[model samples]
Structures are given as structure tokens and as C-alpha cells.
Target chain A: MTDTEKVIEIQVLRYRPEQETEPVLQSFKVPFTDDMSVLQGLQYIKDYLDGTVSFRWSCRMAICGSCGMMIDGKPKLSCKTFLREYYPAGLRIEALAHMPIERDLIVDAGDFITKLESIKPYIIPKEPRTLEQGEYLQTPQQRDMYEQFSSCINCMLCYAACPQYGLDKTFTGPGVLALMHRYNADSRDGASAERMDLGYAHEGFWGCTAVGYCSVVCPKGVDPANAINQNKMNSAINYFTRFVTPKGGTK
Target chain B: MSKRRPYVRSMDGWWKRDAYFVKYMAREVTAVFVAAYAVVLLVGLVRLAQGQAAYEGWLAALKSPLSLVFHLVLLATFVYHTWSWFNIMPKTMPIMFVGGKRVQPGMITGAGLAAAVVACLAVLLIVRGVAS
Candidate 1:
């Protein structure tokens, strides 16, 4: 590397069970061009100074649903975040906030994945049919209702930003709730009755205190807060209507 | 048992270290404070319903050291509840637009707090007028 190339200082949070009780900042001077990302700098360190430094990444292009970390206290995809943005002072990288740290720059995301499954993440039609029938038709407006939520790559920056999720582990959180909203809004899905039962509980929509950090940190503009809050209205209506409406009233 | 295993653990105390988890804990803790203030108001109402002599006795009790300590704690909780309520209010309600531009969250919270202060002052004035 030439002297003309800018040298950026990267400070990463490190934790090892045998050596450290909690994460600590370890800084490294990395030589970089304008095109280098924070992920590349960490890779450089791992390849050179410390082979044991741990993190997660797969699709360097941001599609593989990995390489999420807290860059300067904000949850972001490390592969997409460039060092040029924090030019002079370098960068500080850590694992996603509000999740258990398994090791250096990696958090255990089992809770989020479980909540996703609880909502029956797959489509369940009202009646069984074969492929011989035509595909379930949906209008453009119906597609528009859920188009924004469909963009979620499950990077989980929203989970890190959510204080409510951090406080109540059982609370079905922002990302998972957005996914639920996606399926619920689908015209082909016939599981609203079954899904509403899970979404209406205290541990579901009602648990959200609406800190709104989830919406702010969402990389895909999923707006999971909107999904959770809008569903709260649905849940409340469903609760009140249970007494008035008979079972299987409308198709 | 089936071969399928749930990917996430279903257990307690999982959220202790998460930052978002800590935020939710703070919100729940503030809720206790809100409930405590409600009880204080309910006690006052009961005293008033018992007539002048009973209300005067309740007022005297409120001036005692233990009662004063309780009031201090209540005051702290009420402040927390008020701040948290205002912070989350914008999320629940529809956005307020003026001249085709939306009002800022901080502005909305400030206006709400000002209205609360005015309402409290109006209640004090009415109470003093009725007593005299």
C-alpha cells in the first residue's frame, strides 16, 4: 500500500469466553481505497493480524442475509457500509444490539427465527386444491398492500433497534410481525382466522410499546412498526367482534 | 419425539442483555409508576366523598413524613409516565399536518404537555372558587 492511499482505523468489539468476560474494543490500522467496505477491512484484519477474529458474512452483495453488525451504534449491513463514510476517524463495529453475543461480532438470533415460525410463515389456503387449477389470482391493489413488507431480507437490523423486543424475549417482534403481515395481506392466503388468534395476544401486537426504532433501522424500508401497530387495531376489532359475529359467518 | 426441532429456544430471561429488551423493561417499569399515581388519585376521591372533616383529615395525613415520602416517589413516577406517554404518542395517532407539512414529534409532545399544564391550572382555579 502506498502512502497516498488513506489509512483508516477500525475498532471492532472482541469477546472470547476463555479470555474476556465482556466485549472490548480492539483497533487496527487498515490501508484502504475509496471503494473498500467495513466488511473488507475486518476481512483484512482476520487474514493478517488475527485469524481467530469471528464475524458472519456470506453474499458480499447483501442478499445472503448475513454480515449485520452495529456500525457506530447503528445496526447496519457491514458489506454495504463503506469506510469512506467515516473517512477520518475510521469505524467501530460490533454485533447487533439486543441479542445474546455468542462470540466476537456475532449474536444468537434463534429467538427471532422462532417467532417467525410461530406466525406460520408459509401460506395456508382455505381449501385444498391441485396444480391443475389456475393460480390464485390477486389484483394489483392487493399486491400493493404487502409489497413494502415483501422486501425484507431478514438482515434483522430492526430487531437490534427494537427496545421492546430486547425487554420481552417472548414478544413476537418487528421483523417477524412484518412477515406475518405479509402473509396476512396476501389475497391467496385463507389463514387470517388462525393467524389473528396468535397476533391478538398480549405477547403479540399488544406488547409493542412503539419505540419505533425498528422502523428507523430497517434497511429494506419494511416498516415493521406499521405492521405491528396496524395489527393492534385488527386485534382489538377481532376481540370485540368475537361476541357479535357467529363462527364462519362470511366466506 | 419428531425429528423436527424448533430453531429458537423457548425460555425465560432471554432478553436481559439486549438493548431493545432493556427499552421494553423501562416501559413496563414506567407502567407501574402510572398505576401508582392512579391509586393516589382514587384515594383523594374517596376522601372528598366522605365530606369536609374526612377530607381535612386526609390532607393532614398527606403532610406527614411517610406520606411526604410517598408523594416524592409518586412525583418521580408521574414524571416518567408523562415523558414516556408523550414519546410514544406520535406512533399511535395519525400524523398532524399543517399547511401541507407534518408537525415534528417534539413539537407535538411540547404542545400536549402545555395543554396538560393548562388543564391542571384550570382545575386548581375551579376547586379554590368552589371551596371559598
Candidate 2:
């Protein structure tokens, strides 16, 4: 494409902690094609125009779960966001919402990782399995139960759309909750009790205000809001059952 | 002296302090508002059933400035509750698949709100006819 056809103006929020205290909007006119993604546009600017621009990307396709950024005030995967969607007019891009920007497009993900760990996101068998037993048997119906939640790529787009996640950094947001549901719904997993302690806490299941934006922003159709709300019901049942059952009951 | 590993009480001071917890907390808070509204309406109905004078007294109480302001607040919360409830209805219910296509959330919420409005109008018409 020629310069006139290739040129696409993109406004980016720039922040460098080492040099600058706050973020500022910087515009760049770059050569772009209809086939290219927003990530490619940024790459072009980095390779040709300016090296100071910072962002993250991996897998270039939508699978790696990196390259999540705010495009026109919405959390989206830059690699998946097509330039054709915002052609003729320039576009505005920024770091994901609700998180402190480390530099240009990179936001702190430590809180997200910590929340994931808090949920005990691993399978625990109901009974100890012997190696001779081979893999635990599961029917198609059982696999279908939690298959949707297993699609979560940990993209964190849901976290950006979630105002609750913005207000409270430690609240274990949607991404982690979806992961927790993945394990909890597993037929082989018996760690529901161990995980419920975290899910039932004041800030755990109860903290979700159910804005429903998390499900809207999820790229992989992993309805995190549903997972969290279902857990809320589970937490309520567990709360009442503890008094009625002896030996702490069974899952 | 024994060395103590610094342990953060994850549950302590969680409300409003943690974003992840706040979303669920907000939902619970809204539930309380819904329950309060239900109880208030139920009490009004009970008074109406007792006698005309008792029903009139309930109406008078509602007309009071404090009660009016409280009702206004309740109305706002009720609207919020209704909207949020409809938004989440799709998640709990089985997906409506027609012609091998899943129904959208917007369609569900729109239909629910429309039904609620129609139901409210029907109630108002019935009450007006009964009063006459």
C-alpha cells in the first residue's frame, strides 16, 4: 500500500516511570493494511518510528492470553482487534483499566496472579488413586459439565471490564473465579471443601457485585460471572449446612 | 523470642478494600434492599386487609416526607435490582437455541423489562377499577 493508504493515525497513552511521573497521550501516523491487527500497527511503530513505545504480545493469535489492552475504552486482545474495524478514523489505545500502569501498555498483573493462587486452582481427587488404576474414568456428560470454564486462557480482559476489580485489587476477580469453577466442577476433583474456604470468605464470593461486565468482556465465552454467582449459591448452602451436618459434612 | 512469619489476614478488612470481593458484596447489599422493599409492601397489604382506617394510616405514613424520601431511594434501588436481575437471568437459565443459534443477552433483558412494565401497568389498571 502507498503512504496515503498505509497511513493510520493511532493515539497511544505513554508512561515511563524512570523518566516521567504520569502518562500522556502520544499520536503516531503509521503504515497499516486492512489485513493487519492493532498489534501489528504497534510493532510497525516500534520497528520504524519510535522504540520507547512499550506493550506485550505472545502467540500473535488469540491463544497465548497476552496482549490485552484497552482499545477505545474497552478491554480487548490487540492481536485479535482488527484495524479494519476502526479504519478511516484514528484509534485510541491505552493500558487495561483498574490496574496501575508500569509503563505504556503494561499494567501490574501481580494481584491477578496472587488471586489465582488463593483459589487453590488444582484438582484434588475424592479418593487416592493408584497408578495401576490408570486415568480416572469420566463420562462425556461429566466432561461437558466444566468444559466451557476450561476454555479460559487467563486473558484478564474480564478484570479490566470489572469495576469491582478496579476498586479492589485483592478481590480475586473473574479470571480466578472461572479457574476455581473449572476445578470445582471436575468429576475427579474432591477439593471443593479446601477451595470453598477461599470462595466463601467476605471478599471472596460475597465481594462480587455482579456488574456482569466480566462475562461480556470474556473472549473465550468462559462466563466468569456465572461461575462466581454459582459459587455464591454454593457458599450460602455451605454456610447453612455446616450447622446441620456433623464431621464437616461431604461434598 | 520466636521469629514470626508475616501473615496477611486475607479476610480482615475485605469490604471496599478489595475489588474482586466488592462485586459480590454489592450484589448481597442489593439483595437486602430487595428484601426490605418486599417486607414494606407485605406490611402495607396486611394493614389494608385489617380495615379501611388501618389502610389509610399506612397510606398517610407513606405520604410523610421521610417515608417519601425512603420510597424514592427504594425505587432507585428497585430499578437497579430489576436491571441486574434481568442481566443475570440469561446466565442461570439454559441457553435459548433456535435454528442452531444461541439467543443474545440483550434480547433477554429487553424482553424481561418489557414484561415487567406490562405487568405493572396491568396491576395499576386492576387497582384503579377496583377503587372505582
TM-score for every candidate vs. truth? 0.69, 0.76
Model 1 has how many clashing residue pairs?
7
- The i-RMS of candidate 2 is 9.3
Work out how many backbone clashes candidate 2 has: 14
Clashes of each: 7, 14
Whole-model lDDT for model 2 versus the true structure?
A: 0.80
Q: Best candidate per lDDT, number?
A: 2
lDDT tens digits, residues A1-251, model 1?
77799988999988875677667889999888889988998999999979989999988888777999999878998998899999897788888877887778888878888888888987898666689986777776667667777888988898887766766788888888888888888877888777767787777788887777787777777778777886777677667777788773222
For residue B28, give model 2's deviation from the true position in Å: 11
lDDT of residue B51 for candidate 2: 97
- DockQ for each numbered candidate: 0.09, 0.13
Off by over 4 Å in 2: A1-4, A249-251, B1-84, B92-132
For residues A1-251, could you state the per-residue lDDT of candidate 2 as single tens digits? 56457677899998877666577889999777789999999998899889989999989999988899999778899999988788778799988877778778888777888888788888788887999989999986677667788999988999887766666766888888888888988999999888877788766767787677788778888888888887776777778887787855444
